[model samples]
Target: MTGSFAVTKHAEGAGVIRLAVRGEIDDEVSDALAGIVANAAAQPGVTALVIDLEKVRFLAAAGISALLEGRAATLQHGCSYQVVNARGVVHGVLATTGLLSLFQTTIRRTAAHR
Candidate 1:
């Protein structure tokens, strides 16, 4: 069900940032997601920003917009971006919207991220 939305930022390595998202990504949390991504991607020396959606249960229009926004910000900052662990409805929405290719989906979680 409707779990409270949250985004947790973790520095996975020297130039990589991992944002682990939990719960639903809807209108209520889209802005926060965009802001976090923008900020992370803007960080000096950050070369990659990974969004881990393993715990995301729902994906809405606003969420997709936020994701697109995040991708733009990452690109603007010259940082690579990717989405991982999305499944079920979340995965379906991304694929249907043609964002699955945009985000460069890497569904499997690496041991280092766990």
Candidate 2:
């Protein structure tokens, strides 16, 4: 319950960074997430950051704060940030915090071609 989650990064477009997150995002993973976002922001030509949370099972307050901070950093660097495919408890946290509308979220469906 206190273990760290894994986050993977991928380049979607010319200036977009897509991050896929798996497992729980609590206090234990907040620092790691912050670091990951920082690193992504540091990349040259990254104009947008998108976090895919389809596989995320849990997200705590610390995780939410980290994401908000990341968004601020992205904005300061002239970049946009978003979170996608949030469900269950993760969706509840964002909705309750009024952050659901703050981010550009998209629903993802499994692809049969995969």
Candidate 3:
């Protein structure tokens, strides 16, 4: 693999838990991500979950499956789920897989200096 995946968790909003994922998400890393998603949903007051895939370099089939499972887990928990901040290759994978419309995604913007 050209890259490794790492996950970090943060409370981005009231009742929202954001799981920020970095690097490649192939077979080796997808399972771990599912666990994170499940844990986030089980947290008290977490009515919504967002998986930030902005930094993901590669997303394979396993990764996509994990995300789908995460969405299902959220629904089972009576919470809302979304995947945001995906760009380039990551975004393309989601689009081609027809998953882009399944979850809510927003482009993250950075400040520009003139």
Candidate 4:
């Protein structure tokens, strides 16, 4: 797993908040992810929260937990939740944990495809 990690928030359209996550999502950075998602969901006028994992190279158990927490927070706030660009290890982890079916997902073209 890479040492670097970042989650950048972007406001898209009227009521959509997109969080683009980069690098490894391990124990060290899981809490930050949860907090960011919760905050984004709690914001006024936010109708949906989108988490982008295109650049995520790894996802630990804690990271999965964080994603679940984010989903809960979004639901509690009456907002829709979605996860996008989950590929490679990140995609496998979510699928094996049965979380892939829990959230809405859309296929994204990777750099190689683009």
Candidate that beats the other on lDDT, 3 or 4, i.e. the better one: 4
Which is superior by lDDT, 1 or 4? 1
Cand. 1 Cα-lDDT: 0.92
**Reference-based lDDT, each prediction:** 0.92, 0.84, 0.86, 0.89
Predicted candidate 4 versus true structure: per-residue lDDT over 50-96, tens digit per residue = 89999899999999989999999999999999999899888988888
- Model 4 pairs in collision: none
| Runs in model 3 lying further than 4 Å from the true structure | 1-3, 109-114
The best-first sequence of candidates by lDDT reads: 1, 4, 3, 2
Which parts of model 4 have CA positions greater than 4 angstroms off? 1-3, 109-114
What are the models' TM-scores?
Answer: 0.92, 0.89, 0.89, 0.90
Two-way lDDT contest, 1 vs 3, winner: 1
Runs with alpha carbons beyond 4 Å of true place in candidate 2: 109-114
Candidate 1 on 1-114: residue-level lDDT in tens? 345898988888879999999999999889889999999999999999999999899999999999999999999999999999999999999989988888998787666667
User: Residue 44 lDDT in model 4?
Assistant: 92
Q: List the residue pairs that clash in candidate 3.
A: none
- By TM-score, rank the candidates, best first: 1, 4, 3, 2
For model 3, where is the 10-residue window of minimal lDDT?
A: 105-114
lDDT of 1 at 27: 90
Query: Which residue pairs show collisions in model 2?
Result: none
In model 1, where is the ten-residue run with the lowest total lDDT? Answer: 105-114
RMSD of each: 1.9, 2.1, 2.8, 2.7
**Winning candidate number (lDDT):** 1
Q: Give the TM-score of candidate 3.
A: 0.89
